[model samples]
Target: MPTPTPWYARIPPPLIMLFAIVVFVAVMTYVLPAGHYERIEVAGRMRVVPGSYGTVDSTPIGILQLFRAFPEGYKVATPIIFICLASALMFAILKATRTIENAVGRLLYKLGTKRAELILVLLTFFYGLLGIMVGYENNIAMIPIGAVVVLALGGDLVLAAGVSAGGMTVAFGLSPINPYTVGIGHEIAELPLFSGAGLRSVLCFGALAITAAFNVRYFRKIRRAPETAIGRGLDERGLALAKPLDEYAVSGRDWLLLALFGDGLAWVLYGVFNLGWFINDISAVFLVVFVVMAACSGLSLSQISAAGMKGIAEMAPATFIIGMAATVKVLLEQGQIQDTISYGLAQALQGLPTYLSAVGMSIGQSGLNLLIPSGSGQALATLPVMIPLGEALGLSRQVSILAFQVGDGVTNLFNPSLGGLVAMLSLCRVPFDRWLRFVLPLTGIILVWAWLGLLVAVAIGYS
Candidate 1:
């Protein structure tokens, strides 16, 4: 047999991004004229200006000036790094206490032997709910469990990989509670905090159902008929069944119970009783609660601190990716590339029909999503351009919001700019190819679903 490929040979997302950035800068600087764009105010004076974008000098002078003039921009790295460290430390402590393994085992056992289809569907739905409640950044640790489930059932690894990544992609893209992208989009569109929740939730659920069905069909094919005559091993499948708690002395049930109750109570109070404190900033709250749980679970101050540090260490690469992406944003702003792209798209497509502009604005925002990476950042950058265009086209603010919601959420399924996506990859040990295999088809399905949903929303007088 040929030698197995080394892990690092896989797609190097950061390096590829660097190349793209260089090419973008080269095209924007050398070929494009300085006066290619005109200053334009967007969304009732949102401070957006076009022309002279991506102007950072490729020379040493420009490089030196960047660090000297805008030291504050680099500070954006702090929060990402801090949060990651805290998460790593927390998970490590949980691992040491055996709570993480125990919790997963209990979950698998409770799931029990039943209709495999139902289990898969329920698991997919759980992923969507987790996205809404926990945020995608924190839920990636569950992928190994997903893999174990697939293998345990004698399911195909490819099918298992698809379901695991696909479910996450849908949840993340349609995140109900994520303030980063969806929240920013709503703000730019001037919609309420919970605006588009009805439609967004429905889309998330619909995507989950569609993905579960696809995985189930694939699983059946693998189960009923074996394509290869070679022996199919079951080592990976047995992980969930193995007694992981035996390795660690303590399971920390009380601590886990508290964590679950705390999480549940927070969600209930926020969603049902209108407790603003819990929902207003859930991520911060989650961090606090998990930290407390670590301490209360019989961990010493040193252990808790160490666990937090480890969590942050795990997040370092993700933090770097986010920081680099942000740097590109700064470059875009300086070079006036963002506005130029926005205005150019608007001006070039100005002659298109009215509804086309509405749809195009959404599509345009999605295109920006690839570059901006952060949903919130993209919304802040692009929504100013799109919302007004929507208004000029006689589309309602709601339509504008819906378009953004769909566009912003859908593309993160595979975008490397997303820290959560990287976290998911690390947790699952799923390669980009494996992730894409499962996600591409589901992405197409959701893309069509979003368009149809937009049409339906318009027909129902949302606009």
Candidate 2:
């Protein structure tokens, strides 16, 4: 018999997908007509005029320049790349000091035997908040801690996955302050950063509520009938490896580190909301926190340097992935087919009713997300086009941004290409298929809610 290919092996890596997109766009510059839109400064930001798209002389990128796009993409992606690396390094230093493990161990001990459900609720909300503030990808390191807590509470790996990955997925979809999606999307749409936050906050909380309720119901069922859990068939040794709640104790030093970390997070929030800091500014804050935390934890200078390097090395793949994602935009722009694609989409939606048009935009954004999984990458690639299309259809730019946000985030739960999701699931020993099965229904429900949210935005003329 012929050998079967493993499922994981079948799914192409992000790098491969990016290379394919670059080549595809390079070919497209030869086949598709080159075009552009007229741009004008509006209130200190660039805005593409709604009716300015026009076909222009084709600007085909040679094979040489096709390779050049890689370096150019890396340059464009440097801010996000450094931010991810710096954040990972800070977390690595904290891990080297055993601060996070000891603190989570202490939390598990304090929750005791009867309050498992409370643990679930608390962790879900906590991680969701992290998703809103930092990002979903940045929280992959925390999933193992959540798994240990879930096991200590007699819950299964799926519950652990839910509290960490699932919770963050929901929050990422809805968070008003998520810089990667909402911030970038707004900037691309030429709207005020974090504008329409009041409605987004309400929607985010609603998502949290729905996720919490679902997790609680499932946790109770599994506790009653362990065999019904997704991880039921796994051997005892496998479960033991994932459950490490008894591994460490929280000392006075751990408490101090926790306090300092909390304060650092507060500083980050202040910088972002009050000072209008972007990724570069936030990376600097994390760098400062890394130095202070390393000193307070009593690490020698050499040890801190080593740990920081190790952390950066671990996250090097993620940095590469961000850079590769940027190449998609580079290829489209260089080919001059970006505006051509956008103009076609706008013309196709010309006669649709307002509500249906909003829904179509949401659906289209969702489809695009499968190919371009990075929220900021997708925003940079699509929002310029989408905003103009929305205006051409008489929809608010806010509505266009909302569609992009929900589309980019909601689909992340099931997309196999999301590196962070895959890594977290692997860490927890939860199979991808099981996660798909568990999350599919919730995804459907969320999509319905998102459509309704868009309808409301249209009805109220949200902007």
Candidate 3:
């Protein structure tokens, strides 16, 4: 009999997939006609005029340019890359101080095993809230701590992933302030940034509620019958690491560190919402918080630098993946084929009813997300085309952005191209197949909810 390849060996790494995408897009530059839309300034923002797409001189990216796309993409992706690196470093320093572990351990001790379900609900909601304010890629750094907490509380790896990374992915899709998705999405659509926040915030909470309920149900199932648990096959090392709740007391210094973190988070929210902060501002907030926390924890400058560097090193692959994903956009733009694809999609949508067109836009964006997983990158690549398409189909730009919110955000839960989610699952030691089994149904439900949300937006002439 022929030997079977291990699942891990069979799946190519994310970078390889991204490289393949680069080659594919380079080929597309030759096969697809080059085109562009006429842009006009609208209240200081540039937007594509509907019905202005025209074939342009072919600007096919040569093989050499395709090779150079990595550096070019890195330049475009630098802001997001730095933000992720800084957030990872901040959390790394927190881990080095053992503050997070101590805090979570003490909390688990007080809550006890019987009330463990509440921990699931609370942690899920907390992570979801972070998703709304901090952005999802930034939240990946916290997943291991969440996994440890859930595991120690007698929950399995899947539950840990659910409450942390899983919950965050759900909330991120529904969030009004994700910056990467909603922020850039609104900007590209030329709507005010976070303009429909009231509706989005309500939807965010609803999605979180659904995620919490789903996680809690699975947690109970596993607790009642460990034999049937999804994580029953987890290695001995992982099982042993889930320590029993110890009597670790929170000291004055711990409280101070916690306060710093809380205040830093509040400042970030204020800066983003009130002051209109972008990626660079958010990264600076994390850097400042890390430094202040490190000083309060009595770590010397050398130790803080070491911890921060280690955090960046740990996240290096994910950071690289971000740059690589951006290459897809780079290649498409260089080839001048993005607008061509957008025009084709728009023309196809013209024949559909207005409500169906809204739904179709959401569906199309979801499909696009499979290939381009970075929310900001996808937003930059697709929203310009989708915005005009929405107008042509009698749908408002707000409705189009809403479609983007659901499509780009929700699909991340299952998209293999999403390096952050893949890294989180790896951190929790959960298999991709197992995660699919656990999340597929919830994704379906969320998609239905999203479709309904779009229909409502269209019905009310949402703008």
Candidate 3 structure lDDT = 0.78
TM-score of each: 0.73, 0.78, 0.83
lDDT tens readout by residue for model 1, 1-463? 9999855356466536643663464356444433223334554434343223343333221555444423343455445544444445445555545564555555555665456778877777777776666555555445555665665555655555556766777776776656766666566566787676777677777877787887787776666777731123422422333554233332456456446535744554465336444222444544665666775678788877766675566556665555554555555555545555666666655666656665676677677676676666566565666667666767777777777777778877767656556555544445455556556676788878887777776667573
Tell me how far the alpha carbon of residue 381 in candidate 3 is from the true structure, in angstroms, after superposition: 6.1
> Which digits, one per residue and each the tens of the lDDT, describe model 3 over residues 329-413?
7787788887788677667777788999988887877877876677766676568777877787898988888888788888889
Model 2, which residues run further than 4 Å from truth? 1-9, 133-162, 176-202, 213-248, 300-306, 370-401, 412-441, 455-463
> Over the stretch 4-119, how does candidate 2's per-residue lDDT look in tens digits?
97554465555566567668778989998999888766555455666667899899999899989989988977876776777776776667777765666667666665787877
lDDT of 3 at 182: 77
| Clash count, predicted structure 1 | 16
lDDT of 2: 0.74
Off by over 4 Å in 1: 1-15, 22-74, 133-169, 175-201, 218-315, 458-461
Winner of 1 and 2 under lDDT: 2
Query: Which residue pairs collide, candidate 3?
Result: none
Best by TM-score: 3
* Per-residue lDDT value at 268 in model 3: 78
